[model samples]
Target: MTERGEGSNAALSKYEGYENWKSNIPVMYDWFTNHNLVWPSFSCRFYLQGTDGFVPHTLMITNCDVVKPRVKNAEDISQFNEEEQSPFVQRYKTLIHPGEVNRIRELPQKSTIVATHNNSSNVLLWDLEAQPNRHPVNGAPASRPDLILTGHGNDVEFALAMCPTEPFVLSGGRDNSLVLWSIQDHITSLGSTKGSPKLGPRGVFEGHDAIVEDVQFCPSSAQEFCSVGDDYRLILWDARSGNAPVVKVEKAHDADIHCVDWNAQNENLILTGSADKTVHLLDRRKMFVGGVVLPIHKFEGHKDHIFYEPQWCPDRASVFASAGEDGILNIWDHLKVVGNNNENARAKTRSAPSGLFFRHAGHRYRIVDFHWNPVEPWTLASISHDVDKTGCGVSAVIMLGTTMKMQEQKHGRHLPVYAFDMLRQIWRMSDLLYKPEEDVEEEVEAELIQYN
Candidate 1:
């Protein structure tokens, strides 16, 4: 056991499971908040909840000085706590992004119009209310994109997607192809200054063999979509039929599939996330049944990391949320992990895997991305790759709330202000998993300080 003593006993058992999930965030949260970032934002979004009430829900972040690779030590970083590394964001508004956002998407019919991915193969749209907040220093100057999404020939960063039924834009990269676009006449030049403009491609779709890593759309199709790759295949596109693959699904996920979602209320469901740290659940009408292609319900909960993202829950359709690299964020319910054949519900989910009720280990590191606040309903906005001490690497935007009084006493009355009644009040006030550790922080910062 000397691989630095087995990585210091797995960083002291992931810092004693993040100090028992931070002392059970006040009986598992009725609220939570943490917003800090100087650079490090693979993506975080939630905009659209404004009636001009000054700053009414707007958070589309990115300022990436890249840097990721620190693995902890220094006595596992002096057992953490400096106000958890400061930056509870009291005010923020900046977007000078032109590169290194790696992935950012918003535009379900224009939520401040965005779309970025800058390792590059073109896809930088933005118009956060007409950009121009600057000051991301160190030489500044990258902020000029109101439109420029040319077809990918290579480098596509993280398989983007945007189209809840037109105003389309779908991508997938490293030239493994699947490029579509419609930007509906440039959606009024995406907030206008009208200078970037590049467009192109309304259909490319070749069919992955490697490197697509996530894409989704078919939440009631703007002509169908779905992708996942590094060649563990998932395919399923359809610009009203052409391009290719109306449904592929080979191998589906033994490994590699890094993120995919499409089930805005079950368009025949689909959700993948891999590198094999599981989360399957595919349907698309029985992904092949008799001829073998399966994945009706897998989700083994980040057993050893690698499952980057898997969202669903635009308003809970059997709930969903998953983020990983082992800095957890799970919240499942695929009808209690697929059709209950009730063996006392399979021995109460075999001690934790039966639709993974709720678990969000408050990021000590590696949460990469999260967003499920299609206008606040149990709100969420997570991001992390936490690295501090000036070598920079931070991006956190947590804000969660829960208060499940046994789901309002088993639906005897109220329970619909969003997100599965705060994840059924962190699964019956932390027994589905934890307990003890109070201080709801002024009641989750006065009910999530208007989402900063």
Candidate 2:
């Protein structure tokens, strides 16, 4: 519960109640699970390569289960067994203590837990499952990052996409380059007696006219990768090739391309968002297989027209999300675009319908970026920035579908909020992964209203 105000007596009562809640493990755990609270399990730490480097801190989890008033003192303490408690709870009693909760009312959704000061241009990798208290298997600090691969001359952006098929890392940054590194390289670099030998770059993807904005490995093929950039181009390269892109799509957008996502269901489909205020669907198969150039579809709706990013839904093959300067979040159905195209082709002879299946108008500011929750495909988290008014700021909101009613029911609250925006930007809630089509509907019904 959010504390609205603090009268001296009321504050004391709140503290007394908090102390009671912290002392009871079973009651607290049950309350947490029943309310569907999520604890933070992973964090990302970043540091500028030079001056005063490698500061160590801890990233605290946010959106924890709400604490409730304690049961009467007579409640059976016999039900509490030492083994029932999580190691985390035992180590951090302050996490459950009311005094701590009151002091840190808003949990640290995302923060730098560790700092690095290596002068070599390198990228850092943190193992998500590493225990916070143990040394990493490499004998570098455990529960901390397994390795730090320093080798970039410029600021790194999106430099840590973990490959699903292999224990490798794919990253690109302002240096106009891409590098693939292995976990073993990190282990060896630690120089610990027990550390594994450091691994070096497995491969490097080069050849871009400008700083690369995004680089994605094909979901099904580790042999191929795609990238986009400020030069308004999309290039597909062979992972084995250290030279130029085999296929260069110039003018992929009219302005700088901010993001790119490959459709997991259809490897031939490429989706890109740009500062040009347009989202383009390029049929990769057409370019490579048919030797034809065709834009499968295009979306234009943002007023200010700066689209920051686009994400393809993992559960549904045809579904996608895009956010931009208009401050609206859009969910789209690609099936509708294909259907409309087929109908239009047949209509030099007849007249095709002129609408698409999509949903919009869910945010109040420029949604800087967003990610679909990996565990729950129906849910998404986004960060929005409102820069026009006083006290206006950035916030994070979790979007839920009607299907997740059980989880929503557990929380007893459903409206979105702006409190967690900064957190969403730090730790990625999910990665773009391909799912079997059998798990989701192939056709999207046209019930969604079109956004103007």
Candidate 3:
């Protein structure tokens, strides 16, 4: 993909922020690592494996530069001859995928068991542990799928999820149907197959009018799940009640809904991101009232189209993260926005949107995907499609921490409040918000003066 702001006034201002972020990394993060990918990937997920040996912690990614080259114009060409490159990522293992991976989701019960979707009707499952490590290069032979899921009449590119409660897999496709599968019996024999094995869905639900963009299983149930589609509809499904939708919100957003994620801590809450540039928080219990479903809170923090699913922080009940074409990953505290009546606090932070406490501006391009590290507290792994000088994409793992101290305790210190304006200003002045060249320069200068 071509980098934004190239040959424009915003180009310098954008890289200035990146430099500032790199300089402040030591203070802003407890730990940080950036690995350059040989090819860009639209999806990234932290593996279930621990960090005891050869690999720090296994990470799953895809390579698709052969399919869609990232070097598109002179601007990208200029970056091809840098003297040095970012740290290289060690390949724990590689799966020669059948096609470019449009999206990826792992079985929560078995992280080694991964399901990948492409521009086809089938969902390919891989037992990463059993798959032989192969070097992926141009025209490499495609690896056979350990298990293949069939039922979708069209391509199931992006909408895919795995159940947290059971060995169930959920997928949505262009066919406008939600397909469910169980890998319970196939788990033990996952890697035993030398040829392509196939599995069919236990049930198929039809409701969406357009291609399904995202699907999420209710954290607490195997039979309960939800889906959002290009039709601007959000449908909740229950296998116990047959193929029909249990609850369908016809107009979930003003634009196409791209993603939907159900909260694990609070079963009552669900998050949906749309092209409308908003994340709507829906309460399942209060979904249907007077024959209409309404969102409990509308998060208007994103400034561009929301492309990826908004993910909930596994450890925190009210915290979550959302990213999109805006090239920003915003961390929000729902409790801070929902029913918030503190006019004083609102006035002090009026420059930013309500509930937005932290913003990640590390990526120079749009953030395509991100996953919260369940094993690490407040840690995140994010990937962007921006190509570097070495013809590689950026993958970063960051542990979130605030330099702003909350309080001083007897034994140690507290640094809980991360959204303070002082810290936020560092990124905001560095091109997080678009402004005229003169204004941006003046604001950045003033910020430097204040710090000096």
Candidate 4:
């Protein structure tokens, strides 16, 4: 947190008048359909609203097909258009008792929608092309999922993931069980409408001792992935095998392992963040044959360790970002961090975290998730579930650039908001919370910058 009266940023005058904050947002957006647009790192653009005693639930879908110049690479990409031209998201359909939708993962392979549940152990699957039917016989909606994966020992499943290039879905739950579903077998035909392809549990990988919080498939492989759980374990599993994990690291963290991600550009690299407020970089190539081992590299600056995920920059091999309850989005450059001679420090307790490239503390509350834009390396989307005087709410999506034209807050230097202009046009910016070179002006002035 920045001190209240350390002094103001001198450059805050160059890009002035941030007092009218909401007005400077520029683009116009719809309210209803985009209710969940702020959801952090959402795998899919659609969200489910479950019903009450009598009121029916609504399925809100975003206009992914619309145009957002910032999201595109065309000329005058910064131009903001009116309602007709601006992207619009709306409530697409209605749903019956979907039983507390937890996560939605869109499989790139078939455009299938796989959603996990919080009230039941079952997982829901729907075809993106299938239109929702308001009145299906039972609790199922018109856009009923062709498959509902059952068999997780009656534990409400929250951890859900789909193979990046395949129709396979993986789910984990409180039952300490992991179930893999196959989309091929469950493509049963409907009475009238063509049945959307579905998926059913094909493999049940059992080895976890606590609730699984995250499951991610390798970006390069369809059959290999990793899972992290409250048990403090990180296990690598092959889709072909069911009984045992090919490699398992018990006590992978001093506290619960909340999240794990595979580096897309690297073959053997996987990153894990835990309740210990530390991030560990592991190489799968060296496991099992050896006894207990520490991370090839470890990071220790994070304050919120319970629930956060670290992602390798989709464009760069060495850069990655992490967001969590700390309300901070910290970016790191591995080459600069784990250089030519840090091997000796890789000994006992794995001392030093590669230096942080920069930090954006835009969110006044806790940040739940963040994702790097696969197409735009410098762009990122961060979501927060923190609510306070900032009026920040659950599932708030803030998109901004990594190193952008500077924007500062009223009192102090804030990486979260900047007021930079070129010809009176508001450039593409949001709470996407990223540390910019200019944001540290006040921090450096206040002696609040810390790098280790």
Question: Tens-digit lDDT track for model 4 on 1-452?
Answer: 11111112231132133223224233221110111222222212233433333433334432222223234432233233321222322233344435444555556555434354545777776553454546424444434555677768866544777787667778888888888876654443422245434345678888888888789998877788889988889999986675589788998888888778888789688898887767888889884445876687777676654365688887668777786656566777766556645633443334434556655443444555555544333545454442332221211122222212223434222222111100111122332223444664655656654542
TM-score attained by model 1: 0.35
Between candidates 2 and 3, which one is better according to TM-score? Answer: 3
Clashes of 1: 2
Q: Which stretches of candidate 1 lie over 4 Å from their true place?
A: 1-19, 23-52, 56-93, 96-145, 148-159, 162-179, 182-201, 204-235, 238-245, 248-278, 281-287, 291-293, 300-308, 311-321, 324-360, 363-452
In model 1, what is the error at residue 51, expressed in angstroms?
A: 9.5
Find the candidate with the highest lDDT and give its number: 3
Which lDDT values do the candidates have, in the order given?
Answer: 0.59, 0.44, 0.65, 0.54
Cα lDDT of candidate 2 equals 0.44
Task: Show the lowest summed lDDT stretch of 10 residues, model 1.
Answer: 418-427
Off by over 4 Å in 4: 1-57, 64-97, 133-143, 186-200, 287-290, 341-353, 388-452
- Output the worst ten-in-a-row residue range by lDDT, candidate 4: 417-426
Write the candidate numbers in order of decreasing lDDT: 3, 1, 4, 2
Alpha carbon deviation, residue 263, candidate 2 (Å): 1.3
- In order of appearance, the predictions have TM-scores of 0.35, 0.57, 0.74, 0.66
Enumerate residue pairs that collide in model 4: 33-90, 38-397, 133-142, 133-143, 398-432, 407-418, 407-419, 408-418
